[model samples]
Target: MQDSESLQIARAMRRIPRWWLIPVVVLVVLAGLGAAYWAGTSTTAGTESTPPLAAVVPVSATVERRAVVKQVVLSGKVVAGAESVLQASHAEGVDRLVVTAVAKEAGSHVAPGDLLAVVSGRPLLILPAGVPLYRDITQGEAGPDVESLQTVLTSWGYACPVTGSFDLPTQQALGFWYKAAGFKAPTASDPISQGEAGSAAPKPSSSDIMFRWREFVQVPGDTGKVASIAGSGAILADDGVVARIRVADDAIVARADVVQAEQFAVGMRVTVRAGSTALDTTVAKVSSFLEGEHSENTIPGKDITVALPPGAQGFAAGQSVTVTAGSAATESLAVPLIAIRQEGGRPYLLVQANDQKNDQANGQPRRLEVKITAQADGWAAIADVDGLLVGDEVTLQ
Candidate 1:
């Protein structure tokens, strides 16, 4: 009608057709994003399809260091204590021995029923050689100075054999008797000088030979680290102390007069002292030095003892040691035999925590479970010390 309503108002003012204003700009951007998510500004667009967050970077550790060989300067000294042999314990009557207790002296400390030298074996002289009107075990006989006192104790070696033969070791080396015509100390004093008895009888020197050979001691402790003192044992009974003083000040004891009798034998050579050191030991039997009824068949020197190379406790028993026998025993440590790493295949070495220690202990790493066991000479002994403790410090992987 007026040009068809002016051509539909000029096509609706000619601007709305960019796809029709895209549904009014998508409904005003969904109402301004729901009013900016209800005014809480910006934070609610999760539709749950995530699973894409990764950055990974952890697995490092270390600690394995052991190398203390101060150039390896080992050391060893403390010697002397080895010797054995002694015998005799019967054939009776030959003593005036009177000693009352002296038990184990001469670098002393004794065990095995201890108690040495208590004696009185004097009673020997059974005459009839010429019906000299004499009694037995000595209640008579001692004129002709008893064969000039058994030829001055068999010229002073007293194993006695002077042929004045009335036996009993010439009545136990008879020190001074013959109070015959009665009333003591009178070798017929008819001579403060029977004219020097034709002068000539002083020939027994080494102090007239007297050693009764009895020192036998040393056997107590010390097997601290390198053990092997064998089954060891000892037994005998005729106890005696003060084994030696020598030069006649007269303290040389054990059945008095320094033992002219008291013995035992059979492979004897027992001596095992530790500290300064002394081990020349071996034993099977020996015992009897004196103990009763006119006590002469004396026997007391054993209860059990034997040792052939097995003892260590640092040592102490008159302490004087120095021993090294047969020799052979080794087991040392200090490793590094190939970066070690095998797991179940075996060959392992784990202990690198100081951050894997590329910078060693500096990388601040960690790891553990070692066990190289043995490589020897080149040095290696790690035997699984994931727990370690011998100066702890290892690393080779």
Candidate 2:
């Protein structure tokens, strides 16, 4: 009976289907693959999520001595003022007033006793401010006009009496003037004989010279620059204008907007530019014009007038120019604006603390409090109780 039971158990085991064994084998293989996938995913996640430590470096600049100034650039044009007119006056024994020769042209500088032009064979001369030459001055004339002539002669180092009389000394001085001016002196009138018998020649009169009214023209100013003059051979009526002289220096006139005008004031120093040339000048006047007051086609604004320095050159009327005006330049210890940091409404800088300037790694940067005295062109002029010296390195970030 035990043998029969053992045989029956063997047959039962053999009778079990091989397909059920295949499914168990497949499940074991799938579990192994799932474990491997989970392990790879966790390892990859841990490697990707971790970050490495890094050392940060900052940008830096060196402190330097610099000038800080805030300026406004404006477009302007040159203007001339106080123009004097030279006129052609009627002369004795001359029919037509014709410009015979032009000695000085436009843009020439002139002084007292300078020849302007020639009118009908008579010289036109510039004289100092004096009495109007209404009549001819001959010998023995006594008046304010004669005194004025004497005064001019005295100024020219001539020995003439300022006694309001065209005496011997006056005629002698006039002769000197005529010779120096490259002209011949006018002949005096003939003297009368006493009685045609043993008569002396009346002491031969002091000099044989007289002054004609039309030769000398008085200028309104001491010195001037010619603006315009009549061409040679031009004809004119009595008392016609011959030349225009500028008694005042050139001025820069510019219109500024309301904001820019507010920053401008009289006596401010300025720089005027014409092409490659530049001149230093000062603000002469500042005025405001209401809407439609200054011109019909212009906007309301402030007119800035700048006076060119005495003897300024290379500028002409109506020529375009550039004007730069602002606060005076302040020179101090300065640094780049990027190096400044603000904290709690106070400005500070990160200065390198290392005594060895090149050894940046030896010491940590120090925070320094500073007062910004001025700022311009990306530079800040600073002042501090603990002074920051020039050539010191400062971190920008």
Best by lDDT: 2
For 1-397, candidate 1 gives per-residue lDDT tens digits of 9999999999888956558688989999999989988766444344445678787654322233443221111111222233221111222232322332332334333232233222221111111122222222231334453554456445545655655444555544432221121111112112121111122434222212211211112122210111111111122234321132211110101121113222212444434444454445443333343343344443332222233332345443333333221122244444555445576776654443432235455554334555554453445556535344444344554
The per-model lDDT (C-alpha) reads 0.34, 0.79
TM-scores of all predicted structures: 0.21, 0.55
Clashing pairs in 2: none
In candidate 1, position 336 carries an lDDT of 51
Report the C-alpha lDDT of model 2 over 1-397, residue by residue, as the tens digit. Answer: 9999999999999988788788899999999999999999999998896577886877789999888877888888998667888887775556788887888988898888788887776677787876657877887888988998899889899999799988889998886786677655564563221222133434334466677766777667767989899999999766778888889877898877777787679998888899999988889999966453555445568888999765678988788899888746757889999898999999999888756543346587878899998888899988744647888889996
- Cα lDDT of candidate 2 equals 0.79
Q: Give me candidate 1's TM-score against the actual structure.
A: 0.21
Candidate 2 ranges beyond 4 A from true positions: 1-67, 80-83, 130-135, 138-144, 184-210, 237-239, 246-250, 255-269, 273-303, 307-321, 327-380, 383-397
Candidate 1: stretches off by over 4 Å: 1-37, 44-54, 62-97, 100-104, 108-118, 121-344, 348-371, 374-397
